[model samples]
Target: MSSIIHILQTQGGEIWSALGQHISISLISLFIAAIIAIPLAIVLMTHKRIAEVILQITSILQTIPSLALLGILIPMVGIGTVPAIIALVVYAVMPIFQNTYSGLTTIDPDLDEAAEAFGLSRAKKLVKFQIPLAMPMIISGIRIAMVMIIGTATLAALIGAGGLGTYILLGIETNNNALLLIGAILSAVLTLIFSALIKAISKLSLRKMGILFATLIVLFGGFAGYRSIVKPPVNVTIAGKMGSEPEILINMYKELIEEDHPNMKVSLKPNFGGTTFLYKALQSGSIDIYPEFTGTVLQALVKTNQKVSHNPEKTYQVARKLMKKDANMEYLAPMKYQNGYDLAVTQSFAKKYNLKTISDLKKVEHRLHAGFDPDFYQQNDGFPGVKKAYGLDIASAKTMEPSIRYKAIANGKVNLVDGYTTDPEVKEYNLVVLKDDKNHFPPYQGAPLMTEKFAMAHPEVKKTLDKLAGKISESDMQKMNYLVTVKHEKSSKVARDYLEDKGLLK
Candidate 1:
């Protein structure tokens, strides 16, 4: 509890910023959902069949898995707040629409007749009678949607939409319980606050409620417009894939770039997402640069069936050449460390299975339950490559998040998991990594990757980043990962210390 308080005390500014983002996005999405759902619900009253159809569609939208929906939307709408809001709106619309429609349609027929007998027009009846009578049901729906939006909005962080989930994801990746607790508790608190606020608003006069909602909408719109117009133009935006390593690397990039050009504004988006998300963001010009691995370039992005070379220089050369030719991206010289993929097991499990090599896994293939990240499970150079190279096909493989896999194996939830060579958890968990005797996995030396166009335009930036080439070694990275993951140090501080230690920073 003291540790959590300390983190809150030290990082209070970041926590507030993230909390503001969480509230902004959630309210914006809920507002939009209400705007669409409420009027449509009112209009559908006379057309019962059409109303049913629309409600069924909302139900279908509600049933679609959130992550899967976000995955589908990324390619179309791109990432960040737009896609996150669209996904939330999709989830939010159903309850609001269903409740509003049900409440309006199911109003006592006697009251409707009374309104008609009083010479009330349709609009007047809705305004003075139907809507007021149905207000409670509508407010209940809004409360439900508001709570759901607050909870679902955390996923916005996955797509670079800033929110409290940043702390949650950071906590999970670095194994920091304090950060995790902060994010979770804050999120829960926000939900309760919004739910109660909606309930309180429900007690207000209709005119007051209208004034309040209108004020909120104007405020939200003005806030969004102000952010876009008021902020300094970002000259460089560097992003990184999920993990402590990427976070450290991007911090290093941001620090170096700013040091080189004092007047330049550089932005860092750490733990943005997986390689594909970052790559697409780069292609769309949403981000300027990110750390890329040589082997991932060859296998995942370029998808070349070229001969896999074990030599670090050879692999980096191939990656650099093809990346420019095929993907229109520049691959800088890689650092000395090879953060390659490897299969790991507990020390006890390895001893029991007598596992010494990738080929050894074949002996216990049927008995093994493999936990691999979604990227590794799907990439040709990951599980599929392992199967083809070693003729070992383990049927019981499950897709797991990168951070959770370490805990999963440690707790005996699974006997095997895929991990990077430089990951500190390999040492912390006392896990033994099997040798890839067949050399199926290629060397994954980290390099600064950016669009060729960006590289051409920002030669100074490229030069600044090139200083990292051949800088970080295997032990250097492992130790840095250890410092962040095990010691719970800030990535920015860790990165700065490394740069100072190596005399890389000006």
Candidate 2:
């Protein structure tokens, strides 16, 4: 219980900010949905045959997964809040539209006849009789949409739009139950409150319009207060993957430039996935910058040979050449850290066979269980490439999350595991990192990859990052990774402290 309270206290600011974002996204989406849906509903009622088709089409959109929809929108609209808002509005349309059509259609035909017989035109009957009578049902539809949008707005966090989903996704990745519970509970509470308020307003009489007006004033006034207080931009956006590395870079950029840079403002737009996704984001302009490994760009992006070289200069030059010629990207100065792939086995397993290198592993390869990431298992330059390069045939192969693969090897569930040389857990688990006698894995020096335009615009950025070049030894990087991936330190704080300690911060 105390831990829960502590978490709440620490995350309270993010929680409140997420709430504001949630409200803004849900309300704006609902307003847009109502504007379109109400008019469409009236038309559908007037043309009864098309009502079924329209509802079915909207239902199809609702069935499409929110995450998938966001991905589809990336290439077309890029990232940030605009795509998120468009997705939410589409999600909101179905419920409101169906209810509105039903509401207007179900009204008594005799009431319309009576209004028309009294010399009232069609527009008059619609305004005075049909619309007023359908108000309750229309409001109910809007209420449902509001509740739905409040819940779905959590997904906006996946695209770095900053909502309650940020906490939930982080919680899932880090195994923090408190964050998940808090995000869920807050979302539910917000939905209930908004739904109840809408319901109450719908039931109110004309004399109660004052109460409704006051509610609107307070709501809009609070929005104004939030806008003034936070002062986040209305247009600028920042996007990257969701994890410690990306988070650290994004936060540093936000602090260093977003707050101080006058011409253009910035906000985070995060996505959850692998390096491939981050690369795709950069290519499509969904993200401005992200941390990427030199070897990954070489092997995955450039389709180069997978041979580790001791000389960092040569490796970087090749990487730079490939990125420029192929991907239209530039590799910034390498960070101090290097995260090369290492073959690891439990100390017990290594001792049993006296395994020391790729050559030694090959002798007993058929007897060992191997685990790798799903993509790593299938990539042309991944498991297949490893086998071809090393000439090893393992008894079994399994795919799992990168973090879990380390634990599997440490616990002896697998005899061999693909590991990052700079992952702190390698030291913690006392595993044997076999020497790459054949050099199957390439040098994976850390570097920032940015578009040509971004690099040109921020020439000083490279100089700012150069302070880290060759500063992070493998041991230091392992410790830093542990601090982030294991000790749960905020990445920005970690990066900033490291930079300040190194006198890189001016």
lDDT of 1: 0.90
- For each candidate, what TM-score against the reference? 0.97, 0.78
RMSD to the true structure for each prediction, in A, is: 1.4, 5.0
After superposing candidate 2 on the true structure, give the runs of residues whose Cα lies further than 4 Å from its correct spot: 108-120, 127-137, 205-239, 249-273, 284-286, 303-313, 341-419, 424-440
Native-to-model Cα distance after best TM-score fit, residue 413 in candidate 1, in Å: 0.7
Please give, for residues 205-224, the per-residue lDDT of candidate 1 as tens digits. Answer: 88998899889878888987
lDDT of 2 at 95: 89
lDDT by residue for model 2 (254-295), tens: 555533445556666543566665676678877777767777
Indicate the TM-score of model 1: 0.97
Backbone clash count, each prediction separately: 0, 3
